[model samples]
Target: MTSLPVIDIDPFGTEVLTDPYPLERALLDAGPLSYLSAHGIYAVARYDAVYAALRNWQGFQSGAGVGLSNFRTEKPWRQLSIVVEADPPHHDAPRRVLANLLGPRAQRRLRAEWMAKAHKMVGKVLDGTPGSTVEFDAVTAIAEKFPPRAVGDALGLPEEGRENLLPFSDFLLNAFGPRNELVAAGAPHAKFLTTWVMEHCRRDALTEDGLGGQIWAAADRGEITHEQAPGVVRSLFAAGFNTTVHALAAVMHALVTHPEQWARLRAEPSLARIAFDEAVRWASPVQTFFRTAVGDVPVGDHVVPDGAKVLMFLGAANRDPRRWADPEKFDLSRDPSGHVGFGFGLHQCVGQNLARLEAECLITALAERVETLELAAPGERRLNNTLRAWHSIPVRARLA
Candidate 1:
């Protein structure tokens, strides 16, 4: 067995949590695969190893959960995610249910409605704020409103419960990290999220317009039993909303910092879709996911013991110099679809199309209306165990 390179990633230190990108780049440069005892996991930083782990689910089972430990061995904050954390046969059902809900035809149906909503929202955001400094986080604030309402409406959640979307979704996503202040602070909302989702599955809470209603509809036909339908709605709240919200923030941050890129985007607004993909590759909102080794597995000359935790660094892999030319440069011309910002193979993000549509709508709206969008103040990065995010970004935009 080849000796693994060792690096310490002490979570207690703010450095690792705040900007693991530099550490990731260092690890990738040292070797494609390494071990970090301080983080208490084996790290796969290069594109090849990360891609292999994502593809070979049998070698790195999903039933173990996609966080720092095995769900079978260590209980997750909630029950394991059916789509994001489960493996085959068992993983197939929920994924199919969501695929149908968010399929191409459904996305097509959503595109025009969402674009119009985005335009209205951006119009309000840009209104009276032109030439005045407005925090771009407000744009994210404006942007975050759409997904949950859209997902809630699609899922059949009531109009009254829509306010629970952002707070609940934040708790759900934060729960993936180690039990810390962040997770503890979100407890009340997380509890509400659990109760709301489970109760909605009980058959009375759903409305005809949302997919929550559709899940119950499926349950009536025995396509999905009564037990699984609410979990599906919960999945939408947890997985669907938070990811898209932060992803939009990332793109906004990138465009603000990179003026030339913003100018190019303003000139060719049709490139909005690709800009979102590039932001995914660049910021990599979903930073890392852990995989548990099914057995002794050999990857890139090193052997990981059975049941060991393997951390797939999606952020690192996306910026890996070996696979991506000028990896650090945010080029709109680059083909970023191959990047693992959305995992790969069977476990790839099921809501990616919906996310792309939402992001595209917002980006295009901004590009069309703003002649120039630049940072008003330096941005701050929020540190989470699993997500790379921008906490605050103030901007000055010249609205057309």
Candidate 2:
């Protein structure tokens, strides 16, 4: 049997968190499973290995918590996500409620309304630009603005305190990493955000037709325990907003940097969905998730010991050369179906349809109105433990 390759690198250090590709390459080159001695964790970067771990939930469990701190041993900063942080039996009910509530059929009711909202938002953005060639921060003016208004409305969150959503989401994603400065800085706001989220998730606070109300409705029907309902709502609150926002920013960054691809998208607007998926594959928004080994699980030539934390590098797996041709290049033509950008298997993003729909609406609206999209300046990165997002993506758009 081959011995595990032990690497001395801080996976949560600011350097790797800021720009992780070099470390990702090193992990992949080392082998399917490498031990990160800096953190005492096992890491997997290859697509095949990561995918296998994600799909084998019984072997690689989520109940331990999807971050560096295992729930079995240490207490989480907050209550664990019922869906993203649990395995079968316990995960099934909430997952079913959300999957059905946010599923394709449920999204159809939202599609027309969201598309109209996207067009209106795009028009407003273009109007505010001040010239035929208008320069603006795409992250703030476009990506950040759209998802909250659209999905927030859908979730029936109150209009007041909506500004707090993104910051809270950032804090939540950061907590998934180790107790670093990023997490430390956001810690103060965690209580306020938690209170706000919990208060709003109450059955009275949500509109009857909105997604949050629907989860409560499920609890009413006893599909899920009443105690489980708020956590389910919190799950959506935590996972839904920031991911779509960052994903939008990623797609915009990908398109503007690659003009030919932008032109292709404009020419064939139907490719918006595929473009979003490719962008996600190219610039993974949610980077890494830790899965605990249920028992001695054989990975490649070695076995991960029971109760050990195994980190799956979603971003690295998305670009694995073995799984994708020209993996580094962002191409809409590539079928990014098997990509782990939204993760794989049971814990795959339940809100993916809603996310894809949001992306399709926003990208299609932009493709229709903008003739050319180009970066006005180098974009700044938003450093977080889990997300690869932009602080600002300055761009100049030529109106069609």
Candidate 3:
């Protein structure tokens, strides 16, 4: 019997997570697909297979869950999120409910509000500065602040200990991995996840006009049960906070390095939406999402057996040479609309519009306000098995 090729992914290495060059090179060399022994899963690392896996969700169903394991086979650390883990018939209702709340109408309504918040945050960061160095990561920290705060207010969260939202959201996503240092670090903080969310759903803790109120209204209309209301809010908060932060940082980093792109952005600020999508394709925030095969299926040259777990390497796929020319280069001219950055198929991220809007607000504001952008210091990466993040990005700017 020919043994399957086994590759180990070092989950704890900062270098591996931050740069990911080693893993990318290995995957490219190994061909389209390879078995990852460390996580006991098969990964679609090259462009073709990654696109195939993403598009053929019928064969690569999401009912297994998007994390490292199948929620159907193994229970999630928290309850399954309707948006990320559910299949079609079961996925329809919640998807519709969340979609309506995040659609174009909602974007139009929330635009001024979120844009105003983004401006304030950027202004504060740039307060009296043309050449003063501010850590680019601080912008990420501030940019991420709006989502939790606005989402919290919209959810009608009580003032009691509301700051725990992001920390818990970070912990919860980190919990998807196996019992490693990341998991261990997050395990102790698990209760914060439950309590912070539970408090927001209480009748007394809700804001009258918030999204939490809308969720409650959905319950009243019998769209969702009362028991499930808090989970909906929890899902939004968890999904919104970290993803947006990482996304905003990715765009900022891109602009910092590419002076020409920054000039183009400043020249035509309307490209903000396109710029955000391009950045997402260029730097996928969520690295890999797992899918368990319902049965044996051939992906490229390999026959992955039934009950096997397939790791969809979004990062590798985003820059796949088969799908993208110069796949590694960060180009703003490309149409990244169909990219799997927000994921594809039935389990595509429901909050993608929200993320785009937030990115648009921040990126456009910087384009309008900043005269120039360049790296003041070396950029650094924060490596995680799943998340693509930066620790610090020193930037110097001149006001426009």
Q: lDDT per residue, candidate 2, 1-400, as tens digits?
A: 7778998989888899888999999988889999999889999999999999988999999999998888888867567888899888999999999989998887889999999999998888887443478778989998999888998999988899889889988998898888889999999889999899889889888898899998999998999989998999989889999998999999999999999999999999999999999999999998998999998999999999999999999999998998999999999889999889999999899899899999999999898888899999999998989999889999999988
Q: Candidate 3 local accuracy as lDDT?
A: 0.74
Quote the positional error of residue 375 for candidate 2 in Å. 0.7
RMSD (Cα, Å) for all candidates, in order, is: 2.2, 1.3, 2.6
Those runs of model 2 whose alpha carbons end farther than 4 Å from true positions after fitting are: 128-131
User: Over the full model, what C-alpha lDDT does candidate 2 score relative to the true structure?
Assistant: 0.91
TM-score for every candidate vs. truth? 0.93, 0.98, 0.91
Residue-by-residue lDDT tens digits, candidate 3, 1-400: 3445567875435557657767876776677678888767887877767777777766777777767766767756566765566677766777777777777887888889888888987887777656554444544455456666655555567666667776776776775555567767777777766676767656557876677788778878888777766667667867777777778788888888989888988888988898888889899988777887877878776877887888887887787777788877777787887778887766678788878888888887677678887887787765555778766677878776
Which of candidates 1 and 3 reaches a greater TM-score?
Answer: 1
lDDT of 1 by residue, 1-400 (tens): 5567888765324686787767887878768678887766788889988898888888988788777656767656567776677778877777787788788988989888888888988887777545554444533555467677566666667787677776776666666666677777778567667777667666688876567777677767777667777777667777787677778888888888889999999889998989999999998988887888998988888888888888888889999989999988888988888999988988788889989998888888888788887788787776566777667777878876
* Positional deviation of residue 316's Cα in model 1 after best superposition, in angstroms: 0.3
Model 2: ten consecutive residues of lowest lDDT: 126-135
Q: Model 3: runs farther than 4 Å from truth?
A: 1-5, 11-15, 75-77, 129-137, 158-160
- Candidate 1: clashing pairs of residues: 64-71, 154-210, 154-211, 155-210, 155-211, 155-212, 156-210
For candidate 2, the per-residue lDDT at 305 reads 92
